[model samples]
Target: MLSNPYFKSVLWLLGFGGMGYGLMLLTEPNAEKIERIKASGSNSKQSADDQRKALFMKRLQEAATTGAPVYRPQPQVDKKDS
Candidate 1:
């Protein structure tokens, strides 16, 4: 009955316990499967490189349309004396 103190306490405890259990399940790490999939040395990097090249080509095409000169920055490398 709704008037029973014991029944109210049990319901409250159950509600809090279920919420804590749900939180634990939600926060638990599930990244191991993703790491394992990525660890196979797949084509992710190649796809990324292809995307970058495609973007560069698109930019070049836009520059050609606008008659703009494309400049490439050189990498800074240290000169080592042997």
Candidate 2:
């Protein structure tokens, strides 16, 4: 069974995976840093989403006031008869 090429490859892959996982665990960030990172990430994401929503609503209101099409289609180009 040990002489089988497939089994050998599987064992080699498992060994490398275990070592990588162990390294990740050893080098993992402290809990406080993780929490801070999570908090900042979430706040930034929320603020970005809110800004985007506000901008979109502003544009929609402007379009409505000007009676412009909310969704504009590309203008068709006329082919020149060379």
Best by lDDT: 2
Q: Scored by CA lDDT, what does every candidate get?
A: 0.85, 0.88
* TM-score of candidate 2 to 2 decimals: 0.38
RMSD in order of candidates: 13.8, 10.8
User: Residue by residue across 1-82, what tens digits does model 2's lDDT show?
Assistant: 9999999999999999999999999999999989998887764466767988988899899888988876884478999999
Q: Write the per-residue lDDT of candidate 1 for residues 1-82, one digit (tens) a residue.
A: 9899999999999999999999999887678967986788666556777889989999899888987667854468999999
Model 2 spans > 4 angstroms off: 32-82
Models 1 onward score TM values of: 0.37, 0.38
Candidate 2 colliding pairs: none
The TM-score of predicted model 1 comes to: 0.37
